[model samples]
Target chain A: MKSTLDSKNLPILLPVLAFSLVLMIWELMVRVGCWSTDVFPEPLRVIISMGELISDGTLFKHVISSLFRVTIGFYLAIALGIPLGMLLGRREIVKHLFNPVIQFLRPISPLAWIPLSMLWFGIGDKPAVFLIFLSSFFPLVVSTTAAVISINPVFFQVAANFNFNRLEVITKIIIPAILPSIFTALRISLGIAWLVVVAAEMIAVKSGLGYLILDSRNALRMDYVIDGMIVIGAIGLFIDFFMKRLGRIDSVFWASATR
Target chain B: MGHIVIENLRKEYSNRRHFSRSPGSNPAEYREIIRVLDDINLEFEDGEMVSILGPSGCGKSTLLRIIAGFDKATSGSIRIDQKEVKGPSPNHIFVFQHSALLPWMTVRQNVGLGLRNIEDKARMEEKIKEYIEMVELGGFEHHYPYQLSGGMQRRAELARAIAANPDVLFMDEPFTGLDFLTHMRSREETVNVHEYIGKTILFVTHDIDDALIMGDRIVVLGGKPSRVKMERTLHFPRPRDFEKYPELGKLRSEVFLMLGVPYAV
Candidate 1:
């Protein structure tokens, strides 16, 4: 167990060592007056600020609120996006009719939806969630549609030849074949959800990491601003990691991780 | 009663948008449905091995697909065992040219995929093993399609097709991609499997030698909008050796003549 732990620690040792080196240099530069402490806080000072915010429950409040908006928005996107994708994929008439509309909407940036979201849903978690949903829905629908449409016709024929009914064909052959791509789409959409929600919260909401960043800036606290930015980055990375783990467990996506 | 009949069966695939019309034809005729079969009629008895020999462009594959109900005829009736085949039936098993084994499934899983209703795990395993051994793929049961060589993949497909125990088996150029020795072995395996299973086999191939080796009756189809041109019945003993034929060259010349291939006898 000790040896296994050491082996795993070896991979992380380089990044940990590099982080320490950078921090030491940062401290030295500040002490030498090459860079002002006001402009860039030291690692120790940033850690203290982080700890204080956490201890005072401000950080948790913002994180929890952000998570709530993102989750609701993300779940809504998945529920609606997947079925729409499948419908458009399987039916030629639907694809021909809706493709132009989807193409027109896809190119517009999620940030561009902010004013409309505000106008439509009002300034609150509603607007933020709406923005995240818009951001997440496009990629999910497009990827899943492509996946569903591109299923090998031979697989369908095989199922039919075996007298497998329509439900069985979709549930057994079609779904399993497209699962890898669907998971991929979900991951991409989740990333978009996180990104667009942050931007939306900065303009549309009063609580969340994005709001916290603006609040810190207004109070002239650069350290808290930087701390909020770091928290956002960490959360994004953590979510992506968990999404990938889920993909590996649920789908035949061995290539994505292994390669 | 378990038989197939095709009468005046025709198919026409519409042209793509880019290739709208010929230079000689009217441009307003943007859509062109190229007829693949024209007034073709044929019948197969139950438990018969019939080989369809035709040129590459001929509609042998289309005919098989039509009979299997994989594709619909533009205008025709196909009765399998006196019932019109509207869609794919559980009675027929098709072995495609490329094996068509799902890459994610192992040999055993691929074979047992069609038998999902067989809830008894031991029986499924037994049937899978039985067919796998019949096609000489018992050792490779755990291997995926990608892991197997081309010849092995064909064997796996054969094993899977036979495992379903269908009343009719449709094999379309299943051994064409194999090396000569592998092809010979695979051909032997196909014959052996057919004999053991006693299933009605509709085997399609361009190779006359393959037809002679495995078919109880061979139908030669040729020309555009292909139709059955010639039918020859093979009355040789079971498990006949190909090495003992004295008039093999003459027989091949006749096949070439039937297929419009220029050959000197």
Candidate 2:
């Protein structure tokens, strides 16, 4: 029990210690007049601004809006990309037809789509969500296709020997076989999606944390900008933690553990 | 009714080394066919356990795969019970050399893979339980393949193969990776199971003793572009010992010599 507590406490304790050190350095720099207070506000000032946004509900509203866009976009991408990826993985002809096109599009940044997205969707959450979808779609497709292709040929032989029907092959053999890789892909694509959501919100939407960061900077409320930065970082960390928890499920345990 | 016939079977793979490694530098040498099995012919009677042995990479596995309909021969046919084999079917199951149990599935679920068409739920469960008990993997039914020891994993695979009720079962070096004691136990269990079920099993192995002890008929293949070097029926009774049958010892020594080994060791 004591050892377990020590292990758990280390993760939290070390981060807290580093955080306090950073805060101390920031406050010290401000006191030493590294820059003017207006441009680079003290850490305490940012904390006060964080509390202010929390009580006034602006931070909560922005967080929900950002998360809402990410959810709709990420889900839509997976809903379409995963099936298409499975098809490409299975059929050589389909891969030959679609692979070049996807490879061409994958390297183009989502930020490059901002002007066109705004023109097409005309502001609001639509463009931002579309950007998030575009950012996540290609990586997910590539990862899923690779995952499916790497499934052991032995399992396919097993499937054939048992006379598994087309539907049964997909449901029993392909899906479960690639599930661990799919989880890894999701964690990566979700990170990509989170990154794209911020850049997307900066240009296409009005209420997300990105907009809060940009709007505060324009008004020279550096404290509010810092608060937005901290919130985005915290939320990113939370999302990563959640995905990691999902990976510990019993079905996945077999793949991850050496046992 | 699992009698199998291989007629003038030939397997050749062109050396991809030139193209893949050099990338079109040696265009003329690309179609150079390296034959693995040359004009091979064999017959396996119904319900007979035949163990095939060879020098390593003598196409014992290739031959097994061809007979099981997992791969194609360049110019030949494999007929099982008078039907020409085209592809893998439910009538025959291949127990892979490695544990091919789907890692995500529990022992019960992996075994249940072959029992999918059973309409009665209770009957399906009963059958799964029966096979699990057959391999003495009773309590491990709920455990994943990863959680089990190597011996247990092989037993679970054995249970799965028998549960399928195939007419012919193909095992490609099924005892390749086990420890000595585990390998012995697994081999013993396999013989007992074969005796009880009386299914035709095509077993491929590198171990000469395994072929001699387990097979009703032992067939040895050797040399490059291998063909059957020796084929004989073991008429010696059950629990065959080299000491009890002097001929078994001579035969074992002969196989070792044929494979270019100076002594039995």
Candidate 3:
């Protein structure tokens, strides 16, 4: 009973202690250095500002808006990327045709597309969501393609011997075989989407956590800026946790279980 | 109806060797064509269990794949039930040396894969259970391939193949990696399944003992460019006790001799 309790509590306890230590150090530094609230707000002041933002419903609005963009953009990337990746993975000619273009587009930062995005999609949520989509899409495609390509060829040979049609081969053999890798890609691309949405929002939109940070900075409210940053970090952690849970689903348990 | 006929079957793999040379050096040598199977002609009677025995790299697997319609022969034809073998069909199933059970699927799902086209769901479920029980994997229906032991994985794969209800089953060294006891048990189970279902089976293996134990007809293939070195029909009765029968010992020695391996009685 003691060992189980220790094991269960250790993970949550360690991180909590580390975070408290950091907050204590930050509070000490602010007091010792006598830094102005404009430059470096106290950790307690940031917490109070967070509570105020939460109470006023502004935090909910910003978080919900950002989440909405990520959900639509990331899922859109998935919808387009997985099938394209499957096609490119299976067909050498198609891969050869599109590979150079994909590689060229892959390394460019999604932020670099902001000017063009603003021009194409204009301001507000459209441009920000488009940027998030662009951020997630390339990684999803690359990872999905690699996943499909790396599947055991024996599986395909087995499918052939079983006389699986094209659809059956894809649905039964290809998709399931590549699902674990695809989930890895999903997690990675979701993180990228989350990161890019902040930058996208900072420039192209006016109502997300990124915008809140900018708005608070312009108004000389460092505590509110820190509050926004904390919210973003917390939400990012939640998203990653959700994805890790998704990777543990029963169908793809074989791949992750061994890991 | 599942009798297989192969005539003049040949497979050649061309290896193109790339040579890096200085400006004044000689040009690269021409590509070498290695013949894996040469002029292989064979026949399998309906419901017959035939073992194609060969040493490593002697084209035994190539021959099996060709017969199973997974690989193309350079110069001949294979016919099943008087129809030309064009490509892979649902009527025949090939079990590889490695278990081909999809790692993502459970044992039940893997077996159910073969029964996808069967419209009657109840029959499909019943067949899946029956085959799973046949391979003695009744309790492991929900276990994935990676979760099972090597022997169990092999049994699950056998169940998967048998559940397909194929007209012919081509097994390429299916029990090569199991422990001695597991191998013996699996071989017994294979023979039992063969007797029960009576599906035409082509078992490929490098082990002379495996061939002698399981096959009704043993085809020994060997040499650099492999061909049928010898073919012998075993008329021994069912459940032939190899340990007790002197005739079985003689047959074992004969097969070993054909394989060019020295043996002692």
Candidate 4:
């Protein structure tokens, strides 16, 4: 399969070429009878604006602010969600008791909670972080619960045959068995958390990428607004990449093929 | 001493979806009880290997599960070594038909699971390697279950189960999905392990030849709500060639007829 020009390079080349085509089209739209650069910036103007933001270092500050919120909120959700999900998944009675309430709350949209969160935590990082937490918590719990329930029953039998106590059953059988699903759940929740952090920042705080975009629009610096959007998209891609790499850890490698 | 006595074991299951399907219908009409096993009584001598043969869904696996304490029998009792079976214990291990190795762990780690109680780390490692080698999985110790073939996975599971030092082993269709050569090879491997360990084992299989060739005693189950249709001690010795031994041939056809197969071919 290794010829003179490596066949493995084709997959990498294809995506790059496709993205370049998209950028050319974007530039063409601006060059032809499109709106002025201030109204809707071109790709080059966005890049120039990005360079200016980088030189001023405000971009880094905003990015870090957004990341900090995501980190705290995401960790909080994980710490609480996994244990509760496992408990609910293992015992049907507990699931039945609380699952309805959870289901009803899950679909309410974290955006709708903005007013309540602002009122409860007041406008600052606290409310923004709270909104991010709410965005991630429900999906994490739901996915973890489903993952635990979907585990192969034979592993439990194997656990029983070994005379596993409660702790051993959880650590040895349940945890390891549901690992792949847990990674998937983490990926999805992280995505939701990242998405909510932006919207939350726009409303409750003035130190994040979302605030940068809103502030730029008020000043009519449309180029800076476009730069903020570009940074958000780039960071979102990076988060997904990081999660995919995390899932490829040695423990979950066995599931990579099957999944 | 792993003698097991299963006395009049019976199992019944009501449809789990009955209530949801017809909520207001008569309870008796909606609740359909499926009888899986009925009045199964069997006794195994210490260190004997018993192969249980039956038609598909004849409750053969159900009976084995009950004996292993993975499932509750609707009624009856199972006594192992004079103690009544309550729930699954380390004294008995059941090898599933499908590969049940923990997907996240390597073969070495999987084998080490059964030896978790061993405090001496060196001894545990030694035992793990010994079992892995026993099943000819030594080179694949770091490989996961998905990385191995069907035969390798089964052997790995066998190593894991045997390393636990269970007194009674239950196998449900251990070679159902293997290719022809692997099936023959695994059956040989099972027979060898049985002779070496001399632990009482109860195995369920749909293959008649496996029972004839590998078991010290054979029990055939038939019909819905299955009952033991035939039980016999195979006195004809191992490596029993059908062409060479008239009695083996006679018994093979006899079993075929009993199982409702006309030609015996």
Candidate 5:
């Protein structure tokens, strides 16, 4: 009876317990150390700051802007990456020609492109979106290529035996075969895109959670900085949850379930 | 004419050894040409279920694949209905040893994939339903390949191959990896389907019992670079009971002996 009760309530109870324990420790540290609210604002102060930001519409504006940049950048990455990856995956000669360049670009950080993005697209939404796109594209391409390459050769043989044309093979077999792995890649690349957007906003653009954090920090509003961080973390978690649901759809059920 | 003719078929693979002779050093060696199928000649009349019986790695599957046009012979030619077999065609389908049912597709979809070119939606749907029911997967029509058991997966593949209405069906150990009961049931189902539709079947198997049970004619293959060792025609009628027939038991022993499995008299 006790074990069943524990199992039933644990999901909700544990997180709440852990959160309260952290808050208690934080309050204790502040009391013991006599730290100033300017250096480290307490949880209540952060909550109040969050309320002020929400009431004034600052939080929503920043969040919407960040979301918009990520959306545009991510879709662009998907559009360019998947087809190119499929082409390179199928053609050995093309892969061999471009593989080294892809590898070289893959390792370079998205932050490394910020200066160039600023020079090309200027200090606005364009530069931030460009950085997010660059950040997401490489991982997307690499994963899509791997997914295509790893598809069972038997599928192709079966396709051939059925006398499928090139278009039929691509649409029916290749696309479905690569979808599960590509969805996993989508999750990872979107997370990276989100991370890059924040960094890009901090430097390249003027309005996002990252900009809020930097702006609040410069003005010595530690509560607003902490609030910005909480918002960033919450949004990231939500995006990941959404992607997970997308991967669970019936068409790619076999691939995701195996993993 | 659905007759198949395989003439002097040969397949040689060059096995190049790439091993390290010294620590962390790559070593190069001369390539060795290994003949998997050496000068194989076989013929199958229309509507005949011929079993290519052999030991593992005896090129039985290789020959079946060559005829299906999934693989090319190094020399010689395969002809079906007086036409040269150059590539895979919808007229013939090969059922792989491992179930090749597309994991993403439901049983119905997998079975109907080959029939996508059929213009009549009602006709296509009817064929799909018919094959699914024939394979005893009617209720599980919407289940994915992974959701089914090993036996069901094999049945789904069989349904897929048969639904195509091929002139020839090349099956490479289609019933391997099933439980004993499931194996027997599936074998009976295979025979029933053959009787109903009457497609020419070229089945490859190492099991003497499978050969005896399913084949109208058993072609035994042996030797290092495999060739047809012997051919025997079973005169028994459909659904032959080997347990009741002493003649079949004697033939089974003879086939085992030909496969190099000695039996004490």
Candidate 6:
């Protein structure tokens, strides 16, 4: 029971300690009048600012908007990336045709697509979602393709000896053999998707944590900007934790085998 | 009813040219020359356990692979049960020297790999249980191959091979790396399984003791073309002892002579 309390106390404890340190330094500086509010706000003012954002519901709206964009883009990436990876993995001809194109596009930053995205789809959420998809797509596709092709040849021969047709060979043997690697790709892509969504929202017409940070900066609300950064960090951490849990469930056999 | 026939089998691996070396006066002489297996002819009968005993690079494993329908002969015909062998058969399975159990899968799943289409999950489970019991790996069914010891892994492979109920089981030096005592136990279990099912086995090994213990008849093969040097049939009854049959040592010397190896000191 004490251990459980210790574990539960961790989340509140570290932040509280860090907050206390920051507040002590800020209050000391403020008492000495070394810095003005415009330059560096006190910790108490930041807390009050956080409370105001929560009550106004603007913060909640931006958080939900960002979440919705990330979810859709991330799911789309998985849907498209997995099949594309399988194609590249299985067919030499297809891989050859697309290999150069993928190589050319992979290094282009997701943010670089903003201008072209706006020209193609107009502003609002489309550009943001597209940027997220672009960010997640390459890693997911490449990792899965590498995984599928890297499966042991012995397993392939075994499948052939079992009278497995092409479909059966792929579905029953190749997919299962490569599933662990594919799951690893999904986790990586999810992180990339979250990162890209924030970057996209900062530039292409806005309503997200990124926009809130920018807006607060323009309004001389440094406390609100800090709050937005905190929210982004907290959300990203939560999603990562959930992703790890989901990965464990999806790759139970793989996890146990590796262990 | 699978029978393998190899006639004038030839295999040659081409080597890449070296840019550092200038073209030779006789370019053909400079070409890489390796004739691993040349013009080999053989046949295997149904329900027979034939051991292919030879030194390294004698193409014994290659012959087994061709028989297993994994490799194609350069210019020879291989017929199984009088039908031309085109590719892998559903009723033929090859067991490598190393257990080669899929590391990701548990023993039970490895055993049931060939039976993926069996809609009746219970029946498949029962069959896996039966084979695991046969190899005395009942409690270790859920354990991965890597978790088990080397001997246990071979036993699991044996259970997997038998679970498929293949007509022809091809084993390529299945006990090569095992210690003497572990090798004996695994081979003993393999022999028991063979007795129970009566599947045609084409076993390849370099060990004479293994050939003597497990094979009903042994085919001694030699280097360069890998033709059969001699054939010996054991007339000893069940549970034969090596010490009691010192003749096996004499035979082993003769086989070693044919293989161009000196007899044991």
Highest DockQ: which candidate? Answer: 5
- lDDT by residue for model 4 over A1-259, one digit each (tens)? 4663476888887878899999998888888955987897888888888899999999999999999999999999999999989998999999999999999999999999999999999978999888888999999889889999998888888888888899999998888878888999999899989899889989978899999999998999999998888899999999999999998888877777656
What's the iRMSD of model 6? 2.7
How do the residues A30-131 of candidate 1 rate in per-residue lDDT, one tens digit apiece?
A: 688665676777778888999999999999999999999999999899899988998888899999999899989998998988888889988788989888
Model 3 misplaced stretches (Cα beyond 4 Å): A1-5, B20-28
Tens digit per residue, CA lDDT, model 1, B74-169 = 998998888888878778888887768876567888888766678898887887888788777768887767778899888888777777778889
In model 4, which residue pairs have backbone atoms overlapping below 3 Å? none
lDDT of 5 at A116: 89
lDDT of each residue in A150-191, candidate 2, tens digit only: 988999998998889999889988898778888988998998
Candidate 3 lDDT, B192-253, residue by residue in tens: 99999999999999887888878999999988899898898988887777777789888888
Q: Which residue pairs show backbone clashes in model 6? A: B3-B81, B38-B225
Per-residue lDDT, model 1, residue A48, is: 90
TM-score, chain A only, candidate 4, equals: 0.95
Which pairs clash inside model 5?
none
Q: What is the lDDT of residue A165 in candidate 2?
A: 92
CA error at residue B112 for candidate 5, angstroms = 0.9
Give me the overall lDDT of model 4. 0.90
CA lDDT of each prediction against the hidden true structure: 0.82, 0.91, 0.89, 0.90, 0.89, 0.82
Q: What's the lDDT for candidate 5?
A: 0.89
Per-residue lDDT, model 4, residue B92, is 90
List, residue by residue over B26-75, the lDDT tens digit for candidate 6: 66645675666777777777888888898887888988888788987777
A-chain TM-score in candidate 3? 0.96
Candidate 2 or 1, higher TM-score: 2
Instruction: Return the DockQ of model 6.
Output: 0.41
**In every candidate, how many clashes are there?**
0, 0, 0, 0, 0, 2
DockQ each candidate and list the results: 0.37, 0.77, 0.75, 0.76, 0.79, 0.41
Off by over 4 Å in 6: A1-35, A247-259, B18-20, B23-33, B119-121
Worst 10 residues of 6 chain B by lDDT: B16-25
Q: 3 or 4, which is superior by lDDT? A: 4
